[model samples]
Target: MNNTEFQAARNRPGVERQSFKKRLSDAKFLLILFAPAMVFYILFEYLPMFGLVIAFKDYNAFKGVWASEWVGFKYFSYFFQNPDFLVLLKNTLLLGFYSILFGFPAPILLALLMNELRSIFFKRFVQTVSYLPHFISNVIMVSMIIMFLSPTSGMINQIVQWFGGDPIYFLSKPEYFRTIYVTSGIWQGVGWGTIIYLAALSSIDPHLYEAAEIDGAGRWKKMWHITLPGIVPVMFILLILNVGSLMSTSFEKVYLLYNPLVYSTADIFSTYTYRVGLLQGNFSYSTAIGMFNGITSFLLLYAANFAAKKIKQVSLW
Candidate 1:
């Protein structure tokens, strides 16, 4: 192109690179606002990543991480060969899968239902009650579960007796652990989870609903045609994120609720890693297992994101 055309093209509407000083000055206010979060992330999250070297070494308390003998993949092979590996893997995936299946849709469903509610006061009341469980401490929450499900004098057992049925040990049964864990997670998180969907819902143009009504579309029809499609991108993004964590069951709930009797069904990766690393101080082996979990999670996230982008043109990236 000629200089004239080039000049005209440069003048056309688009971004141009700013001088370093100018760009920094322009973003200074936002940078200042982000300082605290950057510091916190560096200190609490990124700084600790240096310890990943432990996964490769025979970590020793006296010799320290750097001084410890490099063992290559010895610790990793040890974890694979461990007797409990398959059982732990099974439990973790089962719990996480069920939670995603049952728990992920809950917030979306609740938000949609709440949006349908015309009474503002009633909606607020339900939201408040639903979110209350999220703030409760895990220890207290598990304690409450134990109390409610106690075979001897628990309220649930009392109802069972009233129905001429025998009181059963809910927590001890191997078959019941996943159900109890997943259901309790839903109860705790579903309301709080709705908050994001509600925000997404707010961004929908009111005129769409008005236009739908003008077209003689009923509530269900509007939801199906307009509302559902409107929020689908958000739902898919969250679903992909949940898929990425298929190996991570919540450690606190499982550790608190499980016992030897239910270990066959409830022993998961995080809890096993905790017992091996922190309790037993098998640092290298535990680190290897933890690293494996992290790598799998990363792969799952990438796979999910790729699939989402290909199919729906939605992704975290």
Candidate 2:
């Protein structure tokens, strides 16, 4: 009866599924375009995932991955029970939270402000200038930050001295790490991030603005009532994605910027994992730490997506 009904549906117009070979032929151009990324993901992403099992093993370099002893969750238990666990957790969360609090809004506010600009030339200039920092090498960017905040000959300290205040080393103090990290992140990413919001803004119908004008709405009112609402779905999507990475701060920037003097506020899971795995040769221990961070990040992402879908009807799905 099911086969007869399926044959009946297939016989009807537009009810038949394409055969595999036909679908493959139809999608050949798209497959060609996607081939490089597919190969790269298979090589670097899917292949490396096999090593995640090392997190559960007493991995040995000479004995190899499969021959290694199975240690179960000992490394994970050790990490959770470690005295510095809370501090590491706190530092990672605070940095990610601060970044979301400050950095997330910077792009939206910038895009809105730029949207209101009357002169195309000036707006383009501001955008070009804002985007330049993102292209700067991390090493160069950190070096520039160090120079600008230098206590003795730095531009910031120079301003402080002009006000008759003492010069303090910003980089050496633990108190300043989160602020500097978040602020620099905003500076580097704000312009680039705005591209999406700007595109969202552009998609908002011009007819809506015209209708608002005819209804006695001013520029501010139209922007408040129309423009902001237009990009809200995009905002929620980005926010949810940001929440997903709360436990995994970028290792390169943090490692470059931090020293032993600022470890209290600067130490995070990625850096700790790097030190344990690469520097100390504790492969299994560090892999466990990384796997733990990955799990927490996944949970955070899922929770955020769930909440966003419930509250705003907007999510990655």
- lDDT (CA) for every model shown? 0.91, 0.93
TM-score of 2: 0.94
Per-residue accuracy of model 2 over 51-169 as CA lDDT, tens digit each? 99999999999999999999999999999999888999999999999999999999999999999999999999998998888899889889999999999999999999999999989
- Candidate 2 local Cα displacement, residue 73, angstroms: 0.5
Please give the distance, in angstroms, between residue 80's alpha carbon in candidate 1 and its true position after superposition.
Answer: 0.9
Off by over 4 Å in 1: 1-18
Candidate with maximal lDDT? 2
RMSD of each: 2.8, 2.7
- Cα-based lDDT at residue 263, candidate 1: 92
Stretches off by above 4 angstroms in model 2 are 1-7, 11-20
Instruction: Record all residue pairs in model 2 with backbone atoms less than 3 Å apart, i.e. clashing.
Output: none
